[model samples]
Target: MEHRITLNAIAHIRSSFPEKFGIPRQGGLADTRGNIVFEPEYRDVQAFRGLEEYSHIWLVWEFSETLGRQWSPTVRPPRLGGNIRKGVFATRSPFRPNPIGLSCVRLEKVELDTPEGPVLHVLGADLLDGTPILDIKPYLPHVDSHPEAAGGFADRVKEYGLEVDFPRELGAEVTEEERRIICQLLAQDPRPSYQQDPARVYGMRYADLEVKFTVNHETVHVVKIIRSMPD
Candidate 1:
C-alpha cells in the first residue's frame, strides 16, 4: 500500500536573494541576515511566548521550484564539483522523490506586538526571499548537537578563506564593516568546484552592493564591488 503526507506553509522567509543559482547551496552557509515573516493568520503574539529561550530553530520547507510533475532518481551535487552523479536519496539534491528541505537558523530576536504581526529576526539563512516555510521547531541542543555524527561523502569538505582585492574606485563607496562581511561570505567559496575558469567574473548582491569575484583553485578572490542602483 502507498502512503501520502500533506503539509502547509506557516510562513515565508524575506531575503535579498531572488534567484536560485546564487543561493548558498546549504542554508546557514552565508552567515548573512534575513527575516522570517509569518502569515497574518499565524502571527498571534501569544504563539511566540518563550521562543526567545532558544538560540536556533529548525525550518521544514519545500523545494517548491524543484518540483513539477516529474522526478529524477539521480542528481549532481555541487559539493562533488557537479561532475559525478549520485543517487538522489543519498544526497540533499533538490530533485528528490519529495522535494522537502530542512534548515537550522540562528534566531537573532523576536519582534512582537507589531501592527503587521510578530516577526522573527534570523541570521545565516541561505533561503531566498519569499521561500515558503512549512514548519518551525525550536532546536533542542541536547538531542541535536552530535559532534560524532558522520557526514558521508561530505567528510572531505575543506574550509577556505576569501582573498578579496577590492578595486579602489569601488572600495571608496563601501564601508570597512561591509567589506569585512563580504569577505567572510566569499570565504565560504560560493562557486561549484567544477567551475574553475579564472577569466569569468561571478557576482552576487549583498545589502546595497553587487560583489563580483573569481575562483582560483580553492580561493575565491574578490574582483570588484559596486553600490547597486535603486530599482
Candidate 2:
C-alpha cells in the first residue's frame, strides 16, 4: 500500500470570505456565492461535460490556513465551549493528518466558455477566498445523505441561530441579494463560543464591505457597514 501521495489544485474558488472567522461551520448554512475557476492545466471543457446537470456538488479542498501546523490527537472544539477535549479524528478540525476538507455546496450554474475558462457558480459554500480545490464530485443525495444518522455530541447545539437586528439604512448600501446573504450569515453567529462580551464589537469582511456588530443577549445588532477599497 502507498504510504504517501501528492495532489495538485485543479481549481480555486473565489469567495467573499477573506478569512476563516466568519464563514459558516458547514456548507449550505448560508446563501453566499463563489465562483470556481479551474487551473489552466485542468481547464479542458470535456472534463465537465455532465457536471451542470447536478444541482449540488462536493468540493475536496485543502485546509490551506493550517498548512505546516502540527496535527494533534485531541482538539478543543469551539462548538463544545472550547474547553472540552475530543479526539481530533472525531471532530471536523482542520489541523489533522491530511490537512484536507470536504464541503457540499449548491451548483448555481456552470459557465462553459468563460474568458477565465470553465467557471462554476456555486452557492452556500463554506469556503475561504482563493481556496485551492483538489477535486469536485456531484452530490448524490440518494446515496450520500443519512438523515436519521445520529450526530453524537454535535446535535446539542444544532439549532443555534442569533436574532439579527440590521438597520434598514445600512441594508440599503448593498443589493437585495447581498443584504439577504449577509443577514443569513450573521444569524449563524460567527463569534467564537468562548466569547461573551456584549459590548465588544466584532468586524468581519464580506465581499467589499466590513460588517461591524455586537451581540446583546441572543440578538446581534448591526452597528456599522463600512466599504473599503479593493486590494
Candidate 3:
C-alpha cells in the first residue's frame, strides 16, 4: 500500500458561505445551493455523462482551511458545547489526519454548455466557497440509504433547530427567494453551542449579504442585514 499519494483539485465549489463561520455542521442540513465548477483539464463533458440521472452525488474535497494545520487525536465538538473531547475519527471535525472532507449534496441540474465549462448545480451543501474538489461520485440510494443506521454520539443533537425571527423590512435589497434562504440558514443555528449570550450579536457573511443576529433562548432574532463588499 502506498503510504503517501498526491491528489489534484478536479473542481472548486462556489457557494454563499465564503468563510467557515456560517456553514452547517453537516451536509443536507441546509437549503444552501452551490455550483461545482470543474478545473480546466477536467472540464470534459464526457466525464459527467450519466451524472445528470443521479439525484445526489458525493463530494470529496479538501479541508482548505486546515491544509497546513496539524491533526489532533481528539477534538471538542461544538455540538457538545466544546466541553467533551472525542477521538478525531469519531467526529466530523475538519482538523483530521487527512484534510479530506466528504459531503453528499442533491444534484439539481447539469449545465453542459456554459462558458465556464460544464457546471453541476447542487443543493443542501455545507461547504465554503472556493472549496477545492478532489473527486465526485454518484450516490446510489440502493446501497447508501440506511434508515436504521445509528449515528453514535452525534445522534443526540441530530434534531438541531432554532426559531428564526427575520423581519421583512431588514434587508429590502434581498429578493424574496434570498430572504427565505437566509431564514433557513439561520434556523440551522450557526452559533457555537457554548456562546449563548443573548446580547452578543453575531454576524454571518453569506454570499453578498451580512446577516447579523442574536440568540435569546430558542429563538434567533435578526438584528440587521446589509450588502457586503464584493470579494
Q: Model 1 off-target regions past 4 Å?
A: 167-169
Query: Across residues 59-159, which tens digit of lDDT does each residue of candidate 2 receive?
Result: 99999999999999999989888999999988999989999999999999999888999999999999999999999999999999999999878987656
C-alpha lDDT of all candidate models, in order: 0.79, 0.92, 0.90
The better-scoring model by lDDT among 2 and 3 is 2
Model 1 lDDT at residue 229: 80
Best by lDDT: 2
Please, what are the lDDT tens digits per residue for candidate 3 over residues 1-231? 769889999999999997888888889887899999998999999998998999999999999999889999999999899999999999988899899999999999999899989999999999999999999999999999999999999888746678989886885868887887888888888888899899999999888988899989889999998896666
* Candidate 2, poorest ten consecutive residues by summed lDDT: 152-161
lDDT of 1 by residue, 1-231 (tens): 899888878899887676654566666776667888888789988899999999999988888887684767887878787887888887887787878899898999999967768888887787867888998899999999999999878777665565656566766778877776677677777777677798889987776678888877656667777787888
Can you give the lDDT of residue 228 in candidate 1? Answer: 71
The stretch of ten residues in a row with the least summed lDDT in candidate 3 is: 154-163
Each candidate's clash count: 1, 0, 0
**TM-score for each predicted model, relative to the true structure:** 0.89, 0.97, 0.96
lDDT of 2 at 90: 87
